[model samples]
Target: MKKLFIILILTGLIYVTYLNKEIFYKYPEAVRYTLKNSNELQRAEFEKVLKYFNKEEDNLKLKCAQVLISNIPLYSYKKEPETFNQVVDSIHALKNKLIIYSDSLKYNKRMLKKVQDLFVDKMNFLCKTNDFFDKEEVRDIDTLSSSFLIENINLAFEAHYKLPKKYRTNFNDFCNYVLPYRNDREPLEFQKRRELYEKYSWVYDSIKIKPLEDIVIQIYDDLKINIDFKKLSNLNLSPTPSQIEKLQYGLCRDVTNYFVLLFRSLGFAAGTDYITTYGNRHSPIGHNWFFIMYDDTFLPIQARSKSLIFSDIEKIFKLTNMPKVYRNVFNKINFKNSSINIDTDVTNMYRPTSTVQIENIFQTSNKEDFKLCVFNKKSNWFEVDKNFKLNNNKVTFNNVGRGIAYAVTNSFLEPINYPFYLDYKGNLMFLKNKNLKEDIPFNITRKYPPIDLPNKWKIDRIKALNNCKLQGSNYLDENSFKDIYTIKNFCSTQKSQFLFKKEEKYRYYRLIAEEVTSYTSYIAEFALINTDLEPIKNVKIDFYGTKESKLKQKSKITDNDPLTFGRFLNMKITFEVENNQNVSGFEIQARNDDNHINIGEEYELKVFDKAWKRVRKEKAKDTVLNYKSLAKDGLYILHNLTKGKEETVFTFDENGNQFWFGVSDVNDLGVGAPMSMGFK
Candidate 1:
C-alpha cells in the first residue's frame, strides 16, 4: 500500500513537471502572427471567462494552479476511492464542455480535425483515469492502470507523427531551428529541452491554441520569473527567439512576442489574432494591434506597449486595398434591363492599385445623351433609359439605387468580431470594392453568438484611457508560486538556501518572523509598510534572515494588488509548509526617508531587559546623557544625539527587560519625539 501511494504521488508530480515544460516553450510563428493579428483586431462583444480557454496566460496559470491543488485525493488507494473518482469526473466534464462551446460558431475550423479530435479526447480520458490508481488499487486495478498508461503513452506518439502534416513544422528542422535561440545556453538544460520529445512527445508535436491567450496563460504560470527565449521569439519574421530575448525595448510585434513568450514560460494556454491590407492579387499587406484571453477574460493586449489597449483594432478586412481585385460578382447579378444584360461577361473587369479604372464615355453624346446607363455589383444600378447626370465629381441617378452602392462600401469594414476570430472560416470575400451594394448587401455578417461560451465573466482588460492618467493596474500581472520541493525534487532532505539583500539604506530596520497556522494554508498575501514613519519610494527590499527559517514559511513577493504607496502591486503570496512544524515569520523592514537629505540631529529610545548586558546594537559607542522615564514602574530610556538637527536613526532593544540610557551612543537620538512619550 505504501509503495503504491509513493509511486502515484511521484508520478503525479512528474506529470505536473511535464506539463510545465510544455507551457514554458513558445513557438515562433505563433509569436509573429499572434502579435500582428490578435493585437490589432477587435473581438466580438463576447467576454469569455474560463481562464485556460481565455488564452490570457496569467489567468490560465492561476486557473491551472488552482485546479492542480483543488480537491485532490491524499492517497489513491484510500478506502473511499469514490472521492478520487469524483474529482476525475469533474475534470472530464469540464474538458467536454469546453469542446461544444469553445468552437460554437457556425463555421468553426476546430470541428475539421476528426483524427486530432479523437486523439485529444482519448488522451484526456487516460489522464483523468490515471488519477484513480491509489493504495486501494488492487492487482486487477493495477493491470487496468498499467494498460491504460502504456497504451496511451504509445498511442500519443502515433498521433504525434502526424503533426507535421497538421501544423506545418517539419519534424527534423523544428528543434534545430529553435535550439540556437534558447534563453539559457547551458548544455544540460539545452539537452533537457531538446530531448523534450522523448519526455512528453505529444506537446512538441500536434496541436495549436486558437485565439492564443489560452495557451499563453498556461505557459506564464509555469514559467513565472523563469521565462525563456523561445516564448518571445519569431522564427519566421525575426527567425530566432534570441533576437527577442536580446532586445530591451521593441515595436508592437516585439512587445507582443515578449508577452506571449513570458506567459508560455509560466504554464498557461494562449491564442493569437493578426491583420493585413489587400495586396494586388493577394490579401492585405499592411495590418495593425492585439487581443488575448486569460483567467476567463479576453484581453485586447497592446502588442505595441507594456501597457494594455482597449477595443481599438478595426475588425475590417479591406478589399479595396487589394492591388488587383476582381469585380465579377456583378456577372452573377440579374437585372430587369433586357438589352443591357446584368449577366454580361465582366469577368475580365478588375480594379487597380495605381489608378482608378472607369468607363468614362462609351456613349456618343455628352448632355444630349447618346445613352444613359450605370453598372454596379448589386445589379440594381443597371437602370437604362433613365434621367442620370454625369459630371466630373458627381454621378447621380434619379432612382435611389445609386445611393445603395455607397452604403455597401462603408459597411464592409463593420463586420462582426467572431467572423474575424482567429479560427473563423467565415470571412468577407468581396466581389468588388466601392461599387456599393445597389441591390446586394455587403459581404459582411455582424451578428452576435447565442452564448458567451464555457462561462461569462468580467475580465479586467484595458479600458479606454483619458490623456490625463498617470497609468497603473490592468486585469493581469505575475505570480511567484514555485512548486513544492520534496525528497525527489531535492536531492537531499534539506531546506533550500536563500540569500536576501537589504539593498537600500533606511532610517530604521527590523526583522520579523511568524509561524505556519493551518493545513494547505500558505501565506496568501503579505506586505511591509511604513506604519509609523513617512512614505518614500525605491527603498531596498528583502525578507528577514534567520538560519532556522523554513522556505515554505517565508512570505512571497507578488505583483497583484497588495499594500503599496502606488496602485495595487501584488495579489497572493507563494509561501507554503506543513502545519505540524514549529515555525516563525521573517520580515526585513528598513526606512531611509532622509537618504536624499542631510541629517543634523537624531534621537533614540531605549527599552531595557532586567539584565544589564541586554542592549541593542551594543557595539556602538555609549554616550553619557540625561535619563528619564514616564513613571518609575513603567519604562526608562535616555535621549541620544545633539539638539536642533534632523537626522535618520534606528531603534531596537534586547527585550529581556532592563531599561538603559543610550547616552553612550550618539547615533541613537531624535530631537523632539522622545521626551513627550508616557509609559503605556
Candidate 2:
C-alpha cells in the first residue's frame, strides 16, 4: 500500500510540472516582456498573489490565471511589491469572491458586489496606511494595487473566455489590443481612487449592453455636451475624473486623457494618438485625440463628431504631412543593441507610424544591411519593418506603422529619433523641420542707394563761432559734444550712417564716439550736399582720438552721387503687371478729417513714369465697383478713404488683355475720395 501511494504522488508531481510549462508557453511576448522587466519585488509579489488561485477545484481561477498571465505584462508597476502587503492580504482574503466573479456561469450581481466590496475595502485600507502616503512610488498606487490587478485580470478572462471558439486563435489580440487598463499616462489620481473605478465601471456596464458601433458615438456625444471644454492654459495639471466632472473644461490633451481613461476603465482598449507639432506654415502646433478598439479595428473618436469615422478624422487632419503620429500604450519598450539615445519615459506611451526614415549623423564603414525593429510593448525590440541598405547615411523603410523603432547593426542598435509622416500621396516625410524658424519678410522694401556726406567735417560749431574759447572743461571731457545739432543716435554703434530730416542742415558737423568706453570711431567716408543733393566740396575736417585709439579715414568719399540722399528718401511704387499691361497716369488727392478735398494736397502717382502728370479725381462714393467692372470699361478706380496712410490698387481688362497694378500709399488722397486711373 505504501509503494502504491508513492507512485501516485510522483505521477501528480509530474502532471503539475507539465501544466506549469503549458501556462508559461501560453503567455504572449508582450506579457512576458513586461514581467521580465519588473523588479524582483514586484515579480515575487505577483507570484504570491497568483498562488492563491492555483487550485484544482476552481476551474474559473485556473482559466483566469491563464488570461492574467498574459495580460499582467501590460501593467507597469510604480511601487515596490513588498510595500503592497496589506493590499495583497486584503485581496487574498477575498480569493473565493474573485473566483466566483471569474466564473462565467457563477458571475452575478451578488458575486460582483462581493468582489467590488473587497476591492473597495483594500483600497480604503491602503489609502489610510502611512506607507501609501509617504512613499513616492505610492503616488500611482491606484494602478499598482492588487485589486486593480485583479480588475484587469478579470477583464482579460472575460474577453478571452466569452470569445467564440472559432476566434480563439485571436485570443492574443483580445488580450493585448482589447482589454488593457492603460493607454497614455496613468489616469489622474482621485481622492477615492476606487470610487473613480466604480463610476467608470458603472458607465461601461451601462453602455456595454448596446451594440459595439453605438458605444463610441454615444460616449462622444456624452462627453461633448456634458463637459465645458477649455484651453490647456486654464488647467494647472491633469484632473481626475471627479475633478473633470466638476471643472467641466480641459485642454485637448486633458480631454483626450479623460477619454482614454474612461474607455479603458470600462473594458475597452483605448489610447491617445498625437502629433508632436504641425510643421505646416499656417498653423503649427501639437494635437491629441482618442483612438478606441471597435469591431476588431482601432478607430479615432472625436468629441464633436456624430458621424465621423476613423478615416474621416484622418482626412480632416491631412495626415499625409503630419510628420509623426504616436499611439500611446501602457507597457514599456525595450531597445536592443541601441546606438542612439532615447528618452525612456516617453517611449512606453508611443509607437511609430508605418513608413519611417532613419538618418545617421555618424558615418559607419561596415557595408551591411541594418535591421529595423518595432517595439513589442510586451518584449524587447524585434524586427517587423523590413531591413534597408544604408545609402548616403540614410535608410527609408516602407510599411513601418507608428511605434518606437530602432536600427540595429552588428555592432549596436540605434534609435530612429525623428518620426516620419506620410504625405498626401503616401510618401514618407520627417519632422526634421518642426523646430525650424522660417524667416518671412512681411513688409520688405527694395534696397536703397547709400547716402554721402561731406569730407573734412568740423566739430563744435558753437566753439568755432566763439573762436575756440572754452566756457567749461566738461564740454571737452570727450564724453561731451561741443555741438549737439550735428550728432544723431540712430544705432548703438557710432559708425552707422545718419540721415538728416528734410529741413535740418548744418555746414560744420561732428561724428564722435560716445566716450563710455575707450574706443576709436572710424570715419569711413563723409560728404555734405545742398537742398538739391549736389555735394558741397572741400570742407575743412579734423578728428580727435584717445591715446590708445586713432580714426582711420578713407581717402575720398566713395558715394559722391548728388541724388543718393534724395533717392534714399523717395519711395518707389512697384506694379505687379502681367501680359505687358501699362498705366498711363494717376492722381492722388489728400483728404481732410471732414471728408473734403485738401486742394494743395494732391500729387501725381508717377514715381516710375518720369513724365508723370496729374489726372482728374473725385470724392469716393459709398458704392465701390469690382475690379472686373472697371477692367471692362478700361478705367480703374483706386480709393484711399482713410485719412491715415493708405495703399490702393487698380485693375483693368481691355478686350482680352488684363492689367493689374498696385501703388504705394496715396498719401494725399482726400478723405472719402477715389484715386482714378486709365491704362495706356
Which one wins on TM-score? 2
Expressed as tens digits, the lDDT of each residue in 589-633 for candidate 1 is 111111111123233433222211212222212211223222122
The ten-residue window of minimal lDDT in model 2 covers 444-453
Candidate 2 lDDT, 506-595, residue by residue in tens: 323344333343322322234443344443444443434322112222122223211111100011111122222222211111111111
- What are the TM-scores, per candidate, against the unseen true structure? 0.18, 0.37
Q: Which stretches of candidate 1 lie over 4 Å from their true place?
A: 1-213, 220-239, 243-249, 254-680
Which residue runs of candidate 2 sit more than 4 Å off their true CA positions? 1-44, 53-143, 159-169, 188-213, 225-230, 233-236, 281-284, 303-314, 317-321, 332-394, 399-423, 426-680
Measured on C-alpha atoms, candidate 2 has an lDDT of 0.37
- The backbone clash count of each candidate, in order, is 104, 37
